[model samples]
Structures are given as structure tokens and as C-alpha cells.
Target: MTAEDLSTGHTAIGSDPALDSKIKNYYTPARIIGTDYTYKHKIVWKNAIGFLILHLLALWGLFIFFTGGVGIKTALWAFFILFISSEGITIGAHRLYSHKSFTATPLLRGILLTLQTIAGQNSMYIWCRDHRLHHRYSDTDADPHNAKRGFFFSHIGWLMSKKHPYVIELGKRIDMSDLEADWMVMFQKKYYYPLYALFALFIPVWVPVQYFGESFKNSLLVCYFFRYLFQVNGTWLVNSAAHLFGTRPYDQNLQPVESWFVSWLSFGEGWHNYHHTFPWDYKAAELSMHFNVSAIIIRWLEKIGLAYNLKTASTEMVAKRIIRTGDGTHYALGNDDAKARVTAIGPLHPFNPSYTTKYEAPGANLNDQGLPLFHEMDVINVNNKNIKRNFTKA
Candidate 1:
């Protein structure tokens, strides 16, 4: 379909009138109803096989001791990999690359890229492309991982399923010029597969054996397989658990929520409600930094001159958003006194350099047709333009 057809919600497209009519009957660009005639189980074989292997390896973790006990050193190394690699997604992919919440120096950017590669998530370019689509379409059929599809589908099923046609079609609307222009992002995408094997697969197993004198079998099963599985599920929880449960103080209209349990697992990316509400916020939360390691690391980078131009919603901006759309689950939602207290909270830290003198409240912008665009749609388009300008300046 042409951009005009999609914008007008016209079901028909293409040059041939007969073919367009047949296609229109099969698919409607309006909205995805899982029960629609077009809906079908499109299995992604490679992802299915990979996921099956990972799950079996996770089960093997139970019998790891009986197989051959993993040493304390090996287990510790596995845990370390788990945390850092997961942060690579939460900090590198989500906060930095996808949202452009903070700018990183070349050296720091390289380190984050390395860690993200080791995490085994796709290259930053691919991850950001899918992520922007997710935010733009949200619970609609076009969302790459639409939560409305159900917990399992939203969590990992989308990865193992054939991507919906709308996902591919609408994804093209997202301007990726910024990501494409980045030398580092493009380089990573160009060499993603080989780099993934070298960093994610080989290094994890090789380290325990070469440095810790671990048996190859034990290292492969425990440090490499089990650790990789843990990190994958932890990241998945932010998409599943965070979306389906928890409090929605920021915006009840959005499906995403805040879950402390998910926060701990995701290394502080559990503030989903606020994240969907204010995607540009560096912290991804309106309140405490206690659970947000991503924000902390960005702050530290700012201090060392490795990160800059960190974006965050101000107290007034956050308060206005909550008061307008909050579900009253937040303590600061109702009373004037409570709201004041929330606003009174200081910057992330005393020395934090990421502060904004003016706050721009998140909202929808109108299309040429005069209807307001969805917040996510506005975000993707607007952010791309801003990042492109920044890239040119840099």
C-alpha cells in the first residue's frame, strides 16, 4: 500500500484492480483483530529451534551439578556476564541507541556495542528498528510485539512467529536515517552474525575454560548456555510481565506498567508505564533511581565526559502527565501535598549534569489530515528528525 492508502486506512492497494480487490478482502489496514481472516500461525522455524534449544539448556541447569558441578568461580563469572550483557540491552539498545536519551563518546559507545553484541540480541540497527515499530504501533497489529496478543505472544512468541504483514509494512514508515548514518551502528549490522558468534557464543565458553581451568562441557552448559538463557528471559520479562501487570500511575491508557520484580530482573527497566508515557526520559521513571541501573550508568558517563545531552522529563512535566492520565495507583497521584513531595525530589544525584531548564510535556501532534497522531508515532518521526540533526552537527 502507498503511504496515502495507509494513512487513509484504505484496504485496497497495488496496480492491478483485481489483485487489489482480492487483497483488500483478505487484509484490512485498519486494525488487527486476531480473529480476523488474515490472522494465521506463521511459525519462524529458526527462532523456534533456537528457543527450544535454549529452553532445554535451561532445564539442564537443574541437573548441572549432577552432570559435573560448576565451580564457584565459573558460576560467578556466569552471573557477571548475565548482568553486564543484560545491561547492554537496557542501557545500550533501549536507552541510548533506540531512544537517543543520552549521547555517548566513541570509546564508551564501542564498549556498549561490544557488550550488546555479547548479549546476543540482534545488532543495534535491527533492534532499534523493531523497537521503534513496537512503540509506534503499540498494542496494534503493526507492533512487532503487541502485548494485546497475549502474555506469551508479547514476551517471546513474536520472535518465534512469522512477523505480521502490518509489522513489515508499517515498519517502513519509521525513518531510520539516523541509525543508518551512524558508522558504528552500520558496522555492527554488517558484521552482526560473525561478531555474535565470537562475542556471545565463543567468548562465554572460552573464558571459563581458558582462565578458570573449567572443563569445556561444564563451561558450555553452565556459563554459556544457562547464563545466556537467564539474560534472555530477564529482558523478555520487560515486554511481558511489565506490560501485563503492576501499577499504571503514569497513564492508565497505556498497557505497560511498573513492576518491582521485573525491574530487578531487567536491571531497572521495569518502569514500563512511565517509559511508554515518556520514552525520551533517561531514567524511564518519574521517581526513584533506586531500581534504574541504566540511568545511573548514564549519569556516571556524564560525569566522566563519556555521555552528554541526557534527556529526562522534569517534575512539572511528570506531574502534569500523572494528574491528567494516572490511574491513582501512585501515592503522588491525588493529594496536593503528595504531589508536592514527588516534585520536591532532587536530581538523580547532587553532581548529576543531566538537567533541563525547560520541560516539554509529551503529547500527540496532528497529521496533515488534522487528526492527532498516536504518541508513539509522533515519537518515532520526531526523534528521527532530531537525531538526524544532531548527527549532522556532530
Candidate 2:
């Protein structure tokens, strides 16, 4: 069906009662009462088998390459497969579609959608729907990959088990009109399985053998098996490690954490804490910090006019909201500085009811010397006097 046809068929910008009922019914605590006792051994076994086979094939492929069975050309092909698949998940699936952090041209979007299909994840629609739910209800029971559900559940257990009611019923709750309007996304949603079979499995095997002189078995092993395994687990880490460990710079209460190590592995997505707090920020990490390769690519696309509306957070605003927990007290970094400066002026806490919170003077954009000013108080004078007193005592 054409994109126009699909758009016309679905109801636009309206609530779905069925979805609401399902969410309300499933999200209730009573539904989870007996879930703890359910048999999960089969799910565990299946994941174990899948994981084991993937590693076994990857290790075997590496062993063959080192043993003079596979040449450098084959190794290069393997690397290509891994790179493209990782980009598909990070740039295409997560950033562009799930978050709408930026807009790509139709041609670029189509190319990205095709690449993402090869990763063997669900269609863009399914992935985006679940991911939106994840963001909306992060760390709560309604979140599809809630970290509170334990490490394994967030990582892979959710996929192995029966489809959660939320998956089947919450379709209407998500505002995916933009995605639905895209022809490429709609096509991929309907025909993703066939595309996976052809491009991911058969084409990888046939094309390399026919054109590049690679054996069918080697192509399957290196391109299909090894690439597939790497992409799946790498994407999974965003759910498991991104939440379980790392620094919560933006919001301490949120489950997502910022880890430079995880960011490197997951293509700049490891800045989970900042992402959770500022979901629309395109660059997950700060510019002064370690560069996020994915953000670099997106910026490049923007420069070339292929991408637009790249969302970003101001450095000052980001710094202000960053939470610092030390000495058994939590404070907004921006507010803390302001409070400290105000305290120096008078012996009153900013939050104290008796304190006059109002300032009579008009805010100055700069000091007398015309130096650029900030929200923080002028502490140079106070620091100089304290230094003089200490020097005199010494």
C-alpha cells in the first residue's frame, strides 16, 4: 500500500480507548502479584543457546582467519558488516527515528532504514513504539526495558519472554504520526522480514561469493553471523549497562547513567543520564568532552544539508541542571553556586522564609570592567580579602 493510503486509513491525533484500558489493566500492581513465580528457565536456556552460538561462530571465524584459512579481504568484509550494522542501530533506529532528534532527507532516511533492517531488530515502528514507551515511563513498571526489573530482564529477558501486553496494546498511545507518514518506514515495517532474509543473510552470502571471490560459508560466518551478534549485543548494552552503572550527571533519580566507556561502545549513546533528562538533545555528550562519533556524523549531514533541526542543549543550561551529590546533601550545581554567593552577602539560606529573596538592583550583563557575567555571584572581592587575611595570619 502507498504511504498516502496508510495515512488516510489510520485515525489521526486521537486517543485509543482499547490502548488506554490495556495500559491501565496491565500496569496495575495486582497483575504483577504472581509474576514472580513464573517459570523463566526456558527463556534463560534460549538466550544462552543464542548467545553461545553467536560467540562460537565469531571465535571460530577469528580462529580461521589467524590459521591462514581466511584472508585479509574476508576480514575487511567482516569489519564492514559490523560497522554498517552498528551505525544502523545507533544513528538510524535510536537517534533519527526513536527520538526525532534530527531530520534526514528522504533518500538518506531510506538508506538508513534498509541498513537497520539488516540488523534483524524489529521494524522501525515496533522499535520506536517500545522505545517511546521506555522514555516516557523510564525506571517505572510501564517502561519496556525498566532497569528496576533487574539486569537480565532489561538486557535480553524481555525479548525472550511472551510479548508484554504493553507491546500489543499501547500502539495508539504513542505519537508516531511522523514515522507513519514516511514511506520508507512504512515499507520497512511491512516487509522487514523478507528484507532481512535477502539482504542480511542471502545477499551477504551470494554477493561476496560472486563478486569478491569470498566463499559462501565464510561470507555467512563473517558477515551474517558475526555482524548480527555484535549489533544485537551492542544495542542491548544501552538497556543493561547504560542504566546499571555510570554517573547520573543530569538527574540522579533517573535510571540511565552516563558512562564514557559505554558511550564509546554504543556510539555516543552511553551518555544515558543526559539523554534521559534532555531527550531531545542531539549530541549526547558535551563538545568539550570526548566526541560522540554518531553526533559527528549527524553534524556532518547537517552541514551538507541532508539533516536539519538538530536539537541541542546549551552548555550553561546543561551545567545548571547537573546534580551534584556530596557530603550527604544533593544540590543543583547552578542553584548551589547562587545560594553560596547569596549566603556570603547575608546569613540567610535562599530557601529560608524569613530571607528577602528579591534583588532591587537591575541585573547587569557585565561587571565594571566589562567582563562577561554569569548567573553566579561576584566572589572575587570576597576571595581576595580571605586570601589577604590568611596571608597575614601566616
Candidate 3:
């Protein structure tokens, strides 16, 4: 299971692991916020200044809304954008693209690409790469925004700072061939900057001014800045508040927790405890899709033949997983009746689980090789062409 993770198909593989150690020591380690992980956090003045300006503009947008500067239609438009933009990331980048929880047709992929382009997050390829890295090296120095670095760092601070060298080093090792193989993914990656400017900034601002007779200033401030700010923060909440707060019903050893508030805010990604437990589940959460807007939208797509091959962690697996590793916060924590309905599933190999396929989750039992659970992430059958674009990156 110590088989090394493949590269992004961008960088050459380094023979010496010492290169990671070399980068680690060269930088002055910062404060301990992410448990044991610490790294130099050099501020990027431009990103910091840009964010500050955006925050100020968003506040002005809010102030103007109260003073009749913007029409109700403009405000509603922003809200609508929020929903679709968030959907692109949750269902498109995270689930469909990153996890391979479901398959979407080329038409559906184009729609998701457009929506995600509006979101102004990085291209789907990069987004999935970082997401995979986050799962592969959760809570470690290699994690892009290690929650151990505290709420602010995990939330927004990581955006305004240079990536920790370890992040760059480990990031190169994350395989991205699957994403590269997708024509839609690479197309977006190639034109991401232009698409971001056109959809995320220009169009959002221009539409209100052109159609609604909203002032150019109001449209720019509210439709572009505030709407962007809101969606970005909502996404960050899943990274920050979801981890810092909530109960870890699935696995106490992990930092991610189940935060209902986060789910509501992030467009249905708040079920951190269950999500970290079973990343392959298309639902993300173990519970019903009462508030999961992303799950609901994905289901709607499935109905229309836009998405299929949806994967899930069955009730049996979830029930048994809770009994084996839960931190006693699960609803069925002490419900022996529920636990008795599902038998425990032992690991079949040091690598694969008898109950799960393709992707291995966070709480799977450690192997005889004494490798961490993350190592099993790369233990999948790489030769499977059917899942060439599987979200389980190297």
C-alpha cells in the first residue's frame, strides 16, 4: 500500500522523499494552529488587497440595498446566482468531478462547467486536484488548508497567502490524468481565467445594469462583489466552521464534523462527519436530503438522464461503520437494534475493503504495513479504464 501516489502528469517524480524534508526545514515554521502541522505563511499582498477591496464593496452593496440603491430584482438575481454557482462546485466539481460519485453526460458536463465558471473558483481540474490532496493528506502539513491551522486559515486566510512549500511539493504528486482526459475539464482549465472574468465578474455585473435599469455602480457592487463574496464565504464555511465546530459522529479521530448550519450555508456540504467517513457517497451526508440542495439537484438531473451510476454507502455500511468507529454522537450511537441489523465488514486485503469499492474512506482499519489510511487512497486498480476519470486521485 506504500505504492507511491502518481504525479499531476505535470511534474517529474522525485526519487528522493528528502526533497519534502528539505523544503520543510528551509522555511521558518509558523504557529501551531492545525494541531501538529505548521509552515511559513508569507502573505501575498495583491490577493490580500484584492480581498479587502471586495469586502468593502460587498459591505457597500449591503448598505445600498437598505437605501433603495438596488432594485428587488437585482437582489433576487444575486440570490439565484448563488444557488447555481454553489451547485456547480458541490455537484459538479466536488461530487461529479472530484469524487466520481455519479456520471454526467457531455451536455450535463457543459452545463456544470458553465455554472462552475460563474462560481469563479479555479478550473474543475485544479479544484479536484486540491480536493483530492485535502482528503489524501487531511490535517497534515501537506493539506492545502489544514484545519489544524485554525478557523481563519482553513476558511479564507489560505487564499491570501503563498502555498506552504510542502503543499506545492505534495500537490505535484497528486495524479490528475483523469481530469486531463476529460475534454470539458481541460477546456475549462485552458480558458479558466477568461471564463472567470466573463461569467463571474463581467456578466454578473452587466446583466443587472443592462436589463433591470439598476445603476452600474449598484450592479457592480451588489451583483458582482457581494454575490461573489457571499458564495465564497459560504464555501469557506465548509472548510472552517464545519471543521472547528459540530460533532464527529462518524469518526472522532478526524477533525471534520457534522454541522447543519454549514450544510445550509454551503448548499448542502455541511455534513462533514459523514462525508469524511465515506467520500464515495453521492449524498455526502448519511441522512435524508431534506436540506441538501446539491443532492436534490443531482437527483433531479438523474431523473432527466443527465446523470447516472450514482454511488452510495448503503444503510448497512453506515450503520456498521458507526458502531465500529463513531465517537458516540451518531443518532444510532446506543441503538443496539439498529446496529444488530447490519453485520460488521472486515477488511479483505491490507488495501481493499470487502464492503467498499473504488475509493477507501477515512476510518477504514489500518493495514499490517502500518501505513496510514491515506495510503489506501492510492491502492485502487489504476488499470480500470471504465473509471479513468474517477475522483480518487493518486
Q: Each prediction's TM-score against the native?
A: 0.77, 0.69, 0.78
CA error at residue 27 for candidate 3, angstroms? 26
Query: Model 1 over residues 1-394: C-alpha lDDT tens digits?
Result: 6777755647543367886676665564344322233576598899899899888987686468446578888888888888889888988998888878778888988989989998988899888888877676666666777776778988899999988887777677776888888898899999999999998889888998999898998888887788888898888888887777565677877777777778767877888889888887678776656777877877788889898877666566677888888765565555544333322125522122221111122232212121112232222221233322222110
C-alpha displacement of 149 in model 3, angstroms? Answer: 0.8
Q: Write the per-residue lDDT of candidate 3 for residues 226-340, one digit (tens) a residue.
A: 8888898989888887776666667767767777677878877988878877787678898755668888787788889898777666566677778777766566564444223
CA RMSD of each candidate after superposition: 9.3, 17.2, 10.9
After superposing all C-alphas onto the true structure, candidate 1 shows an RMSD in angstroms of: 9.3
Q: In model 1, where do residues sit more than 4 Å from their true spots?
A: 1-38, 65-68, 335-394
In order, the Cα lDDT scores of the candidates are 0.72, 0.62, 0.72
Better lDDT candidate (2, 3): 3
Candidates arranged by lDDT, highest first: 3, 1, 2
